[model samples]
Target chain A: MATHLILRKILDTGFVSEPPPAADPALRTREQDLQEEILKVFGQALTVRHVDAGSCNGCELEIHALQGAHYNIEGIGVKFAASPRHADVLLVTGPVSRNLEVALKRTYEATPEPKWVVAVGECGCNGGLFGESYASCGRVANVIPVDVEVPGCPPTPVALLQGILAAVSR
Target chain B: MRIGDNEWPLEQRPGCTPVWRGRVPAERLPALAHDVRGCGGQLTALWGSDDRHLGGGFAIHVAFGIPQGTAWVSSDLGAEAPAYPDLSAVFPQADRMQRAAFDLLGIVASGAVDARRWLRHGAWPEDAWPLRRDFDAATRFEPTLDAYPFIQVEGDGVHEIPVGPIHAGTIEPGHFRFSVIGDRILKLEERLGYTHKGIEKRFEGMTAEEGARLAGRVSGDSHVAFAWACCMALESAAGSPPPARAQWLRALFLERERVANHLGDLGYLGNDVAFGIGFMQFWRLKEEWLRLNARLFGHRYLFDRVVPGGVACDLPAGAQAALTDQCDVVAMHVRQLKEIYDEHAGIQDRFVATGIVKPELAARLGLTGLAGRASGQAVDARVDAPCPPYDQVKVAIVTHDHGDVAARAEVRFGEVFESLRLIQELVRRMPAGPLLAELPTAAAGAEGLGRVEGWRGEVLVALRMGADGRLERVHAHDPSWQNWPVMEPGVLGNIVPDFPLINKSFNLSYSGQDL
Candidate 1:
C-alpha cells in the first residue's frame, strides 16, 4: 500500500512547471538586426558548467532554483554538465577568490572552443562586497573574459535564465 | 560548569544567551579545557587575534560549551614568538581551527598535528598575516598557487581519486581526495578553504553596524542566523537590547531560513537518487515559501533583513494570515511527499546505511547542529541555551541514533514539522512595535561574542572593536568546521557513487566553514 503512494503522488501532483518568461529587450544589449543568424546555431540546446569561485552560495541557490518544477530549465533543452569538457557555456559565480584563481583559469581553458562565459551575481559583475583584497581577486572579468554579467546580490531565477539566453543570442 | 580557577573573575555579558568570559595565562588553557570536557563540555570556537598595537602581545581565544552556558577563555602570548598549548588532543575539532588561526594571525599552537596551511592557500605571502595589527587590508597580493600534500595509502590495490575545488553539483568549492580499493573507500581527506574571501580581514573596514551585512554574507544560506549573532554581539557590547517585538520577528525569520534550507536539501537528496516526484513537490513547496519571503520581506534569502539592533524590516500587513496559510499548505505537501520518500525502496536503498557517523565518533569530533542531532549527539542552541525569542518559544529537540543518511533525512522531516508549528505560533502571537533600533556609537577596545543555532549548525560570531570605532576582528565560525572533518570518517566504508547522496544528507556548507 505504501509503495504505490510514490506513483500515486506523482499522478496527483501533475507537472508544475510553467513556460519561462521571454527574454527582456533591455538585457539584449546587442543590436537585434546584427544577431538574427547566431540564434539558430544553439537556440535549442545549451550545456552549462558552473564554477563557484567564491560565492556565499547565494547565486548558486538561485541557479539551483532553475532546475525546480517552477522554472524547469531542463524542459527547455538546457542542462548542467558534470564536466567542463562536455559544456557549451561556462556559468561562473562569486567574486573570484585568490585561492581559486588558477583553478578558474584552468577550468576555463578546459572547455572546448565556441563557449560563452556568463558571470552571475553582483560579485561576478563588479566584485560586489569582498572587492579586491589580499585573498580575493574580485569579479569574474578580472580573471577571465565574461560574455554576460547578471547583476544582483544574486539575480533571480528568471534573471539568470535571461542572462543565459542573452549569451546564446550573442 | 565554571571555566577557570578564580585567579581572574569571569564576567557575564548582558545578552539573551548565557556567555561567561575570562582571560587567563597561556599555560592555564589545557587544564581549563580538561575541566570543561570533564563536565561534558564541547569546543565551541577557537581563534587568534593580534594585540601588538595595544602594548600587549597576541591573544588566543577559545569558547567551550559548558553546563551553564558557553565559557570563553583567552590567554595572552608574548609578541616575539606567540604560541599556546595545543588542545587537539582534548578536542579533535581544534586541529583545523588552530591551523586557520596560525594562517591568519601568525600565532602558533605549540604542538598541533597536521598543521598544514588551512585558509592561506598560497594566495598571500608566507610572511604576510592578514589579521596582524600592521598588515594592510588594501594591498593586493599577486595571486599564487601552492601544492597540498595528501597523505598516501599503500597496499596491493590502493589507488587515488581526486575530486574537486569544483564538483558536478551547484555547490561551493572544496577538494576531496579519496583512496579506494575495488570501489570501497579505505580513507578520504578533504582540503578546503577555497572560499576564503578575506572576510575577517574585510571586517576591519566596517563599523559594528555596517559589520552586520558582512556577517550575514559569511555563509549566505545562514544569513539570518549569522546577522542575528553579529547584532546580538554588537548590542551586548554597546549596552543596548533589542525590543521584545523585534526578537519575535527575528525568530520567525530564522525558522523560515531553516525551513528554506531543509526544503532545498530534501529536494536535492531525492534528485540525487532520480526520484522525480519527491524533488518536484518539495521544490514547488520551497518556491512558494521563498516567494512569500520576497513578498513579505524584500529578499528571497532574507539577506540583510536582520540588522544591527533588531531587524531591517517589519512583518508586513496580512503576514499573520499569509504565513499561517503557508505553514498549512507546506505542511500538507511535505507530509504527502515524505510519505512517498519513506515508502520508496529505491530512495531508502540509497539513503539507509549509505554513509554513517557513529555517535561515539560524533561526540569526539565535535559534530554539531542538525547533523549532530541526527547522529545522536543531542546539541541544539535553541534547546540547550535558548537565545531571546527561542527561549520564549518551546523548541522540541529532535534526534535519532542511527547515524546514517536515513536518520539525517528523518531529522530534517521532523524539524520541518516542528518549525512549521513554531511559525504558526509566532504569527498568531506577533506583537506590534518598532522594527529596527539605533545602535550606540561604536567604542574602542571592547569585545563581544554571539552564538546561534543556525540551520547547518552552530553559528558563532566573535567581534572585537578597533581604533576609530571600527571592527578590529570578526571570527564567524560555522558548525561545518566540526562537521566537515567527520565526513572523512563518514565515507570510510561507503562506495564512491554513494558519496553525493551521503553528502547531501549532511548538507554542510563550504562557504560558511571556509570563512
Candidate 2:
C-alpha cells in the first residue's frame, strides 16, 4: 500500500527530464556545440574525478550540489568517473596537507597524461586560512600543475561547471 | 568529598566551570581520577598547556563532566619529569587524547597503553613539539613522508585492503586499513590526521576577534556551531554576555544549520542505498533551503555569520515571514519524500540490521551527540545544559534503541522536523535589539569554556586570553573525536561493501577530528 502511495505521489510530482538553465547565453551555445565536438575529440563524455586533499568539507558540499537536480552535471556532457585512470580532469580541493601530499602526487600520476587539474577552492588556490605550515603544503599548485583555479571559500556549482568547461575547452 | 581526602582548594573561575586551581602531586592524580570514575564521571577532554613562561613547568588539565556539574583537575608536571599518570585504565577514550597531548606538547602519559603519535606523522621533527612555548610558528621543516605503523592483523587468511589517504570520491583524506577474509571484515583500523593543518599552533597570538574566524573554519560543516562556541568562550572570559536579541539570532542560525545538514544527509543516505529518486528530491529540497540561507545570510555555507559578542548580520524586515513560508513548503515536501524512503523495501533491506552498534557498546565507547542519541546514549547539550534561547524553548530529544543505519537515518529525519518546528517558533518570536555588543578586553590568563549543541554533536571550545588581549590558547574540540572511534565497531560484522553505507551513517568529519 505504501509503495502504491509513493508511486502515485511521484506521478503527481511529474518528471523533470529537461536540463538546468545555463549560467550564461554564450556558454550555452558553446556547451551545445561542444557536446558533439567533445564526443569527436575525446571519443566519449568528459569524465571528472574529485579528490579531497584536506578540505574542511565546505567545498565538498558544493561539489555534491552539482549532481543535484538543479545542476545535473550529467545532463550536460559531463560524468564523474570513479577512478583516476578513467578520468580526464582531476578536481582537487583543500590546502594540500603534508600527509596527503604524496597521495595527491600519486593520484595525479595515476591519471593518464593529457589530463587537466582544477584546484577548486580558496584553500586549493592559495591555502585559504591554512597557509603553508609544517603540516600543510599551501596550495594545490605547490604539489601538482593546476590548469584552472576556482576561487571561493567554496566556489558555487555554476563556477565549478565553468571550471570544468574551461579545462575541457583547453 | 572526591578531593576532601586531600585538602586541595577548589576555586570558582569567573567565566569557566568550577576549577581546582592548585596542583595535585603526580602520584595523587590517578587516585583523583579513580575517585571521579567511582562517582560516575565522564572525561570530556584532556589537554596540556606549556606554562613555562608563567611558571617553571607544564600543566596537564583534565575536564570531567558529571551528573552534578563540570570540574577541571589540573596537575603540574615539572620540566624534568614531564610524565603524568595516565587515566586510560579508568577511561578508555583517554588513550587517544593522551597520545595527542604527548605529540603536540611533549606531555607524556606514563602508563598509557598506546604511546604512538596520534596527530604527528613526520610533519615536524621528533623533538619539535608545536604546542610548546619554545616551538616557533614560522619554523619550516622539510617534508618527510614517513610510514605510520598501523597495528596489523597477522593471519594466513587475513589479507589487507588499504584504502586511500586520497579517496576516489569527494571525501577528506583518511586511510582505512581493512583486514578481511572472503569479504567479512576481521578488523578495520583507521589512520586519520592526514588533514591536520596545525590549527592549534595557528591560534596563538591571534586577537579574540581573529580567533573566532579560525574556529569557524575548524570544520566548515559545523561553521556556525564552532563560531558561536568560540564567541561564547570569548564573551564569557571577558565577563560580558551577549544581548537577548543576539542570543535568539544565534539559535535561529543554529537551527537553520541543523536543518540544512540533516536534509543533505538524508539525500546522501538515499543515494548510497541506491534510491536515486529520493536523493534528487531531498537534495532539491536542501538546495532550496540553502538558496534561502544565501538570501538571508550572505554566504551559502553561512561562514563568519556568528561573530564574537553577536552575529555579523541581522534578518531583514520581511525575511522572517518569507522564511516561515519556505519552512512550511519544505516540511510538506520532506514528509512526502520521507514516506517514499520508509516505503521502499530495497532501501530498508540495505539500511536496517546493518551497521548495528549496541547501546551498551555505544555507552562504553563514550559516544556523544546525534549518533549517541541514535544509539540510545541520549545526551544532547541543548537539552541537558540549555544556553540562552534553548533555555526559553523546548527541545525534543529523539532516541532509538536499535543502533543501526536505519536508526541513524530515522534520527536525522526526526531532527529535521524538530528543527523546522524550532525555526518557525524562533522566527515568530523574533527579539529586537542591537545585533552587536561591545566586548571588553579579557583579563590576562583568564580562561572560559564554550559548549554548543552543533548539528553533528557538541562543539566545545576552551579559550585562554593572553596579555594585551591576544589569544594565549584556544582548543576547539569537535564531537567527532568521540564518535569516530565508535564507527569502527559499527562497521564490524557487516560485509566490506556496506562500509560506505555505515561510514555515511556516522559521517564523522576528518578535518574536524584531525584539527
Provide TM-scores for the models. 0.97, 0.94
Model 1: clashing residue pairs? none
lDDT, candidate 2, B385-479, per-residue tens? 67788878889998998999999999999999899999999988878899988889989988887878899998888878999989998888888
Name every residue pair that clashes in candidate 2.
Answer: none
Q: What is the C-alpha lDDT of each candidate?
A: 0.87, 0.82
* Worst window of 10 by summed lDDT in candidate 2 chain A: A23-32
> Model 1, range B1-515, lDDT digits (tens) per residue?
34443333577877778899888888878888887777788998999998888899999999888767788888989998899999999999999999999999889999888789989888898878988968888788776658888999999999999999888778889999999998999999999999999898888859776798888888888989999999888887777888888899899999999999999989999988988667777888899999999999989998888888888788778988999999998898899888878878888999988899999999888888998999998899888889877777889988999899999999999999999999999888877788767877667877788888888888888888877768878888888989899999999989999998888888888888787
Q: Write the per-residue lDDT of candidate 2 for residues A1-170, one digit (tens) a residue.
A: 66786677677767544454433322221223344455467853688999988888899999999988888889887888889999988999999888788888988999996677888889998998888887788899999988778888878888888877776652
Share of true Cα-Cα contacts across chains kept by each model? 0.88, 0.78
TM-score of chain B of 1: 0.98
Which sections of candidate 1 miss by over 4 Å? A25-37, B1-8
